[model samples]
Target: MIIKRTIRPLFSVIFVFAVAAVTLFFRAIVSGAGRDPYPDQNPFIISQTKHIPSLFNATLLKFSDVDLADASLRQNVEQLVDGDFLSFRTNRQRSFLSAGRYRLDIGVRNVRGSAMDLRSPEFHQLRLDFRRVLKDWWRQRRFDSEVLSKSNLVNALKGVKYKSCAVVGNSGILLKSNRGEEIDRHDFVIRLNNARIGGYERFVGSKTSLSFMNSNILHLCSRRGGCFCHPYGEKVPIMMYMSQPIHFLDYAVCNSSYKAPLMVTDPPLDMLCMRIVKYYSVKRFLKETGKELESWSGLHGGTEFHYSSGMQAIMLALGVCDKVSIYGFGKSDTAKHHYHTNQKTELSLHDYQAEYDLYEDLVNNPQAIPFISDKFKFPAVVIHR
Candidate 1:
């Protein structure tokens, strides 16, 4: 009886240990089943079991047979699985129809596709209309053809390409930075609106390879005696985009006597700038606020809404320079709207925040930029505060 009692307790202890061991073994196996196979590889890879639902939803949204066949879509799905909420939302918007309906068609596509082609019939008509207006003004003024030909910017810059270019803006943040020497180091330096550089050369460089201005600035300059627009010296090239249709008269008068090239922006290039800025502005508006796209015009000036000169200069630099650096392109509450001017308020027309977002995207992921052709290779960009 003593041996029986002792063996019975021992068997009970053995049974308890056996049950515990089996429980732990199964728990370990189940835990390991959801673990990452290569924990050290690809930090963006989805590892947590909780995120499986999100992964599955994204996969379902993107996983059509056609999309599955596309290797790029597969890569995009992998990126989506890593939780890029903004991109995911943008994809959701694209994949869904109006009024909460869904569409099965899915593949990698730009949120807004490329701008109108320069060779398209619409562009040709635009060019013709622009030339007709300019020619009508030229006939009234009897402008010299020889002088106009001499000042042709496209001809002058036909073979010209810069290895490095700096596009300097007039934001008041420039006053806080001593980037003059750094700005001057570029192969070419482009200044906007002829911002004053005499007393502020330490903060803004004195070197000026090109001056980019809007038609309004030139019109104001035209009011002066001799139409004196040479803020950056007479030898510096000036590129201006038309702000009003009547500005061609100012161009005709100024280009006649200007020693350096004074050229209007190409019609196609102007259209391209317009489309790109609008796309960015709309995207930013939708992302930040609950307002609809139609409400954008009312928030921004209705007919007066226009891109700033700085944005267009950056776009021009992207096309002509191998490396582009942006300086003095931000705003602050304590700072003046322009470093050289007493104006303390920004104009309502420019969406500076959207432009800044564009600059960030340009620096971080140029491939994600919308309304630009894939055939155009984007230059390396850096933004200086």
Candidate 2:
């Protein structure tokens, strides 16, 4: 009986030790390397995609219903159809706003008539084949309190008078171009990703009055559940409202301010305000009130990026800043990566001669400002490929 008691006690002790050991080992595993129970924490801007399917078929016709502003003239775009007008491809990316190294125009033209108005039957046949080229766009999602945040920079930017801004593209050239200090000297500086120099006050000076970012970028740089390049603590002032006001996972996240800064472009920043946001008027929106504007957009929300780099450069040159410089834009027909950030999609070869010709026509138009770039020399874009 005594031996049985001793055996029982020994077994009980062994069981207790085994339980404790397992708990400790599990805790150690949880605390060890490769233990990443955390969320995405990259310093790049990555808005979790809505409207777009997480996994899309490599081959599918994609079209954008979003507006392209000046890129798409109000007049329906109709011209010669040589069986190839435009096409879209999303093999490894959610969207390609512009074609990469290859010469491709990345946008949709609003044609008033149906897809069957081309002169030759080949045109109609081509349209059917290219249907997937015109059927993709980011959709609008409801503002989930748990998932979305409004523009905090906008609310904090009251009474700040920012006149000019320099949006520095972080091309490899920026490292050697010697434009760093000059870019920082401007009233504002917009840099993407961590880009090293953003926080180095010693290198680039103070924060460039306001920073402009897209949703994909903001999500990557957020700290709560995102990246932290500008770090979410110190409040940056709000500047002009950006284009493609996507709040609804449709609205943008800007600071509210009473004294609105100078809008960098025309048609007004308030025009970019979400239809869902209340106090949507430009006057009220810029008054620095911390109120959400009533959403005027339908369920689909505005998911298009209306301003291309060229368009934004033009907008800034014409409205925001007195002088403008271009860098890190337009590859040499060989530097084929479409985006500076982490976009895995490849651009399709779509003939945009019609669009390019259209742009050229505008340049020669009588109403265009002859010396538009002012004193800057815009190298003639060799588009004869």
Candidate 3:
């Protein structure tokens, strides 16, 4: 009897230890490695509880009643498109006014003035993480002597004050719009992805002030082994935004090889753009902001976490230009992917809808000095001629 009791107690003790081990393992899995257990200890821009699925569902319920075809334009959008336009131009203004706040809160305005310092201490703090990655890439450069003499990227556009700027996208809608003359009239013209402008110049304009592209494009171009120069014309400057650390190598090489003026995006500004997208993603997809500006946009929410190149170019224009005009932005029923080629634009990759919303917001914002449509011409209907 005594032996049986002793054995039972020992078995019970072992069972207790086994249960504790299992509990600890599950807890670790849930919390993630090196993460604090308490919610208070982990602070984020948006609450963690506002999960993507819930946010998307809420967005749908809020805008279920709105008609996609004939909805009124949002208070922010100045231009009116026909109901037949490919994407719904409904006034789905987000409650979060992040665009203006981004410039004001993140000190994007500080980059202006005579001395545009890229290596300032304040600038460094904002892009510290990106700077670290860049430093690593710089160390791996084959020829360190090829480095730029000037630290700032703004030197490329020195003594240039853009009074009116036109940011042109590759959307096929430009082909039919016949807005090339108006686009060429702008003081400065910005294009994305080194888009083709040879024959399309009549539609896209011939003037090329600045072009924005990511490093992946440069790397791919270099790998393709083509003499793919002069996409932006003979001597136009380029702003290459680094998407990864390895991109710095391609950038350095391009700087050495290419005769045209080339510049890189400052890391702080890059991060600031990222945060602005995050803010919009939350406001449009997750929050209870019940503002219905579109009929079918919520379904695609939580997919695009990054801003489009066109949007980034527009933001850059806002920093430098007195007035900004966007051309060839939205999709249309008859329009192809691009005006230059037969290629199709992937919608899932970038948040085009959100970017479109911002365009409308810029129109409504009175404080903004830049007029989106100072003498803008909308597409005209043709009866016979």
Report the Cα RMSD per candidate. Answer: 17.6, 24.2, 22.6
Root mean square deviation (Cα) for candidate 1: 17.6
The residue pairs found clashing in candidate 3 are: 74-91, 91-293, 92-293
Cand. 3 TM to true fold: 0.53
Of the two candidates 1 and 2, the one with more favorable TM-score, higher being better, is 1
Q: TM-score order of candidates, best first?
A: 1, 3, 2
By lDDT, rank the candidates, best first: 1, 3, 2
For residues 1-385, could you state the per-residue lDDT of candidate 1 as single tens digits? Answer: 9999999999999999999999999999998886766565332222344534221122221211011113543443444334232354344322211113233223211112223344566435434444565654333322121221222332545546789999999988999979999999999999999899999999988999999999878766755556678888998989988765444544654565678888777655555555556656666665577576567667867555677899988887877788999998998887888999998877888888878878998999775554455566777999998
- In model 3, the Cα lDDT at residue 181 comes to 84
Q: What is the alpha-carbon lDDT for the whole of candidate 3?
A: 0.52
* Per-prediction tally of clashes: 0, 46, 3
- lDDT, candidate 2, 234-322, per-residue tens: 44422232322211011111111113332222222222222111111212222344333222122112333233333233223223333
- The alpha-carbon lDDT assigned to residue 299 of candidate 2 equals 16
What value does the lDDT take at residue 73 in candidate 2? 21
